[model samples]
Target: MSEKRIEELRRQIQYYRDAYYQENQSLISDYDYDLLERELKSLELAHGVAEGSPTVLVGGKASEVFAPVKHLTPMMSLDNAFSEEEFLAWSQRAGGGPFLCEPKIDGLALSITYENGVLVKAATRGDGETGEDVTQNVLTIQGVPHRLSGSNHPAVIEIRGEVYFPLKAFEKLNADLVAAGKPPFANPRNSASGSLRQKDPAVTASRPLRMLVHGFGSFEGLNTQSEVYQLLESWGLPTTKQFAVAQDATSAYKFITQLSQKRHDLEHEIDGVVVKVDELSRQRELGATSRAPRWAIAYKYPPEQVNTKLLDIKVSIGRTGRATPFAVLAPVKVAGSEVEFATLHNQDQVRAKGILIGDTVVLRKAGDVIPEILGPVVALRNGSEREFVMPTHCPECSFELAPAQEGDVDLRCPNAESCPAQLRERIAYIGSRAALDIEALGYVSATALTQPLEPSQPPVQSEADLFDLTLEKLLPIRAYVLDPDTGLPKHDADGNPKIVDFFRKKDGSPAEVALKLLANLEEAKTRELWKILTSLSIRHVGPVAARALCNEFGSIEKILQASEDELSQVDGVGPTLASSIKDWYQESWHQRIIERWKASGVQLEIPDFAGPVLTDGIFSGMTIVVTGSMQSMTREDAEAKIIAQGGKASSSVSKKTSFVVAGPGAGSKLAKAEELGIEVIDEATFIARLAS
Candidate 1:
């Protein structure tokens, strides 16, 4: 290949790779991407290609949109080992014996920094040393803790780990995307990477991403690499349990081999196995090169591919009333499992691929990712082949599918309320963890409750039925069907083991589960008003906006009665959403559901939260200024304490200011308070007032 060709390939590969890994949106297939990268690598070796090729980069540069943060210690890359021989060579170079081997997760790398035993900063491993600050987004991650769990935590430490999207969550995310007429992500790693870099932290929080601590950057009171792992676990950080301490190359190689075999079985994706020297002192002595650490190595497995037939293509309607197309394939074994269905993404994707029915297709499955049709074998296509097309009308509701808005890709069915399929899915989203957080009410159970079975039971007609789910209605709700012979419930490609509630109980038995669920449903009815509002499936009303509405109106009645102008005044609730919220109440279906909910005794109003805030006590309506850092709490906390007792917290001290709470290092605000002849009190007096 020419130097120009290599340069073009390099930039193209990098852009697509970023879209794939960082944005969880892919522009090309894995094989196409691999071919481009391999071609660039080959040409670079021969032609001495241009400098700064993304092929040589560790990770994609942090997006410039976010504020940059530089690491105290440079986050370095590990040298690669494609074969056992290459890995064995590295083990020999490390001086042999006592190595730690853990799964090298195929996900985004992040650095989490803790100061004084509290998590203070979290950043992506951008271009190795420098990264974008993602502390807010990282805080929303379930596995990542805001505070260290144990008392034995390091005073100041920087822990490094991989953030990954689980397969099951990835499937749900892709389904939602498809429902919205958006393209599905290529794989879990790409999904995790893209989700973590979201500008809105709430968006990142909704993705099913988890972190596994593997190493540290700047640590105090830790002697060995093993201690780092132990400490991470003690601090309630998760680490891979499937690891081995190898004393020699043979043992290490054996563990890698074992992991390679078990890679497909993992819940999260792993590209390779990371082997590092056991001792921290030894790591320092071995030292690392500018490109990679000499003390550790990564043994990467080759990509797995399988050939299969694209039997048929079909479309499915989602809760959002968006149409998504998927392919039915002749069952073929991939990654040691039988696969049948794969997504074609959207109509644009189908046109781009030029795929036809009755064509031989190449399929590939990476660690824990769903098997995907790479492309069709044009040579193998016979005259019997037929071109596939997306339907003009909704398959479920029979309504004409139209683009959500002008030029939008998502083709949605306007029959959102009446559509049986959409209603079932919407109910599931209402009970989903991100919305109402109804315990044990997953998509399977939710759909089961909505979909009526034969002559025995009637389908749950509305949200009202959910609130009134008596024991009689619930006992027949199936979680999933069990395999008659294996006694194991069959799982989908994404490892969604829970099938939609068939008309029978699963291995756990739906009867006993119903008893627990009855109480759970009762508890769900009284959830926060914000949750109820968000779960109503109103357009433009997400978690953050819903919470803002709750803070503004404080009750369901107040929110519904709010004029469009008044609703727009709430922070984050724009004019568009305000209009949507008001219009939602106008819909006959919504009004019916509201009336039914009222009759069913569901909690429709926000709970009157009575605590700490002394409404009419002393300090009522007074403006209080807090300055400097208090010993017991921060300045913000001190100000919040004042506001809790029916007072207003002011940043500036003016003549009208009633009092100022001053602490050590109280500067301009304290001096201004004195100048204004405002009363100043110590933290002791402030605490005494709060107590009283």
Candidate 2:
């Protein structure tokens, strides 16, 4: 068993190493790969070490894309220590004491040779012994000086450094790429590596690349590691200002801790801190391994980016019938969570990313954000990988799919009224806090009511059927407890589709959820008219627009009677939105939804608006924009209040905006408000105004 596992680990590590070094891609996170390597080493120690085991090797060989150059002094990789224990162990082995610590920049390592104070050749760190020539590409980087500044420079000094893409510039570059309908670079490290190896120097120059000297390939006239950095800086080469000399292991660990806290604040991304023995004599005395020097070790932090296989690409029909393509990924842990799916956005996004089913893709999950597929590891693709072709018909109803407007990238299902998927999504949305606020009638219950198990009729067919679901209809119903995000049925440990007697107790009586849902649905019928309008799934009509429409027309009858021009005259309703509302009202099925809901005791009118009161309106003709989270009320409630007081609740801040309600965590909108010199008030002030 040990021998078999060792073989498997060897192959896996080799594959990942090749992906990282030769292909300019990372198939696994640094921390994960380290664990794998440690496991492989453990197993090999128990069993005999196999020939060509990765534990004895340095890195993958140079790729064929560039000319390979042998280094005068081989560039070795640093051993990694993931925890304090491991770092202490390494420190003890290396004869302990003062160490030089610097942030381990996540970038491509390079070795540049300067002959007689003039720049000559530059290469990538390939296989420790030989590296790929990237002289012209390296020269394109802005800050790299062509010639050394001081006359006291060595005859031939091999300066080792890292070429990195700035985090800020990386975001802009990715946004620009997406805007141009091109595949975005995966992460800063791979992006920097790929950029530095471009065939065209102009292409390399176009990218925002910077280099910071870290070490030297050939030691010449440098006594201490600190002196080496000072010498490099004197020669006009960029070196890290974040480096420090620590007295001992504990102090070094403190340095690592401090740097990790401010890692994101730095211009470049740092995986960890590199700890090296300070004195050159001690470093030489400690000797080196074939793969790494014994004097240096990198302490890696937990990774946010990982690579996972794209098992499939599936389209989910949303409440508004927008068909969004999402990737079904092989489960992988990233940023403290297990990620099984990542959104591809639309068909155009899938194409732009150049991803294929069965290909390994880079997955990134930052703090509290949705996991994103940066792009695919094209180097890992085999001929077996398949291109994802979006279906021309809706998977739920077999309705022909088309773009809502010409030249729009997203495709939509027009069977909004009857499609099971759309009905389920819309029903779930109606229960959302943004709509009718029916807490018990969530996605699971929505699915159970709309798409029950085989041989059982669905209790609710559409939003119209929601108010009419009886105990008899619900008690007998059984449905699959689907994945809320994908709406696909979940399976059990035995691999069969999991089914639940959704609205029933085991004894065939109505369940607690069923009772709660019924009560919630009954209560939802008496909600405010704007909430009812928002629950209809009308395109472009959110709470704000619904409130405006309700305030202007007072009733559903008046809204249906109103002309497009008349509807457009409402504060929040523009011409396009007005046309959409009119078009929605003209549909026969939509008319049935309104009539059936009205028949079921649902309120569809604003209360007590017998005469024009615009002159007496508290905020008449005012366009107020609310930004960020308020402690007293939600943005929706705030907007609703604005509409009730006869003010236009606008989403965008502009010169025409009357005032801006700013709260905690307000971002660009508040900035824009300040930039436009618009009147801005805090949540307290806005609440006072509303009360008055």
Candidate 3:
């Protein structure tokens, strides 16, 4: 079990690493990725470690498009500390000291070499040992000096620095890209990386790129890291003025805290603070690890909150027909990603947050979690800001909207089966990784099939019609790629909707996406019964409940026939889920969907060799709730381990919950557990309990 989990973690980490380093894309935020790697490192320490484990790896392989250059000295990555305790622990390990603390610039690392006071070559920090030679592109950056000043430099020196896009420039660049009908880059770091790696030096030169010296590889003259920076500045190279030599760990931490407070004021993004032993002799004495220097560690700040104009408040219809209000904001960067829309949950939440249209709102995004509207900057509001009004009718279908139950905060559209917006979301959900995992049937494909721009009749009106689609049916499909959160068409600079012939080329031939989707639909029919159940969009019935139901009943027919009491008897399927499943199946439209899917040859029975049933184990009948950031494992992995031990991993805290595993940053759930007098344990205690 440990081996299986370790392999899974390794695979996940490798995928993200490759995306960030090779593809110049950030699939997840830095903090979330760090948590995953931390979990993997912890797991490897407990269970045997692998040779190629990401925990022991540094950066990624150099791109084949560029010539590889071996570094004079390896450019290792830095281990991260998310909390002060962790930072202090590193300081203790380094034998306490006056340390140099500098902002950990969120950018691409570059190693520039100078021979006889003349800038010669620049390369990326690819896999630490070898890098992609990008001398031409690096020379294009404004702050990178072509030649040293005053000529007192070493005969040969390798300067390590970060190549970054200034915040203002990044914003303008994104605007320019949007104006040119091109997709904007995700963040400044990715934009900088993509610009630096451009094959054409002219293209790189056109971008607003800058550099900041952070360290050096083969500088014989420098006695300390701080001296290296001063020397770099003297040589007409750019260096950060933010660096300081702190007398102790407390002072170092103080510096980090102060920097974090004004992080947004900086010209370039700084995700964390790098604290290192100031003296070169001590750095060597402390030595190094395979992946990072033991003398240095990065203290990462929590997710950032930024202010953006709340252009308007709009409602988005979900797969469950729930009408959720979201804030349409002037796009802004937050937590290393561009955030334009943030969910306000429902009407009550909008009122609670005191957010008004045209007001400056505080937006917070943590890791890859969805952006959240914390509240309005009430002080910044002018007379122009207006209150949001919830619509009486469904925006998509023009059907009357009402709460599912009396006094409920949320409103829902009753036209669930045929509402284009709801159907689009449901079809897209079916293709999500948690459901059927159909790669080709994404949000764009879902919208094209259900709500085409050149609409006569859409190719698909319901998910039931999804499998029946043919090339002829899909050939005429055209749609604008609508923003999933706002349901508004994306437009070009001239304010025209960007219509895509989703299933065909401009020349009218069937496109690759169309053929792939058809093949995927056929393949989806044979997926495990759990996936089919999950794809049904049944209220409150997700992967866990679906798997439990399939394991107990084996077939969808048996589940359909089962009473609510019988359904609730399955592990992880409580009365609420059972009722929801029962209510869902009783709808005529849902029944038709099932019948159509059955006729379409979808396997609705559990496979014969469906792995272990997991009916009994150490934690049998116990409902465990794990919350916050666990140091030893991710919440998902923790839940999986709990389930493997015959426990029901629940999301909420209630009277029936056996206990709660609380870690750092545990919030409302921990409070609820304490209020309910339920037993609570730390992650370490919980892990030990699992072992016992």
Which candidate's lDDT is highest? 2
Q: Clash number for every model?
A: 1, 0, 0
Give model 3's TM-score versus the native structure.
0.55
Better of 1 and 3 by lDDT: 3
TM-score-superior candidate, 1 or 3: 3
Residue lDDT tens for model 3, 1-692: 87888899899999988888998866665766877888888888889677888888899989999999999999999998989999999999998878999999989999999998888999999999999999999988897888988767788889998999987688677667655755456677888999999999999999989999887896565688888777778888888988999999999999998777556546788889999999998898888889999999999897565667889888889888899988888998877789889988888767655567997765767554579775554444469988799999999999999998899888999888878889999999998876898999988888888888655468788778888989999998778888766788989999998888889998899999999999999999998787799889998987677778887888888888899999988877889999888888888888888888889989988668464376678889999999877776767567757776888889899999999987755667887897899999988998888789
What TM-score would each prediction reach against the true structure?
Answer: 0.47, 0.74, 0.55
Q: Quote the positional error of residue 543 for candidate 2 in Å.
A: 4.2
Runs in model 1 lying further than 4 Å from the true structure = 1-9, 20-22, 27-51, 152-155, 220-223, 305-363, 366-692
Worst 10 residues of 2 by lDDT: 608-617
Give the Å shift of residue 538 in candidate 1.
47
Alpha-carbon local distance difference test for all models: 0.74, 0.85, 0.84
Q: Pick the candidate with the highest TM-score.
A: 2
Model 3: worst 10 consecutive residues (lDDT sum): 373-382
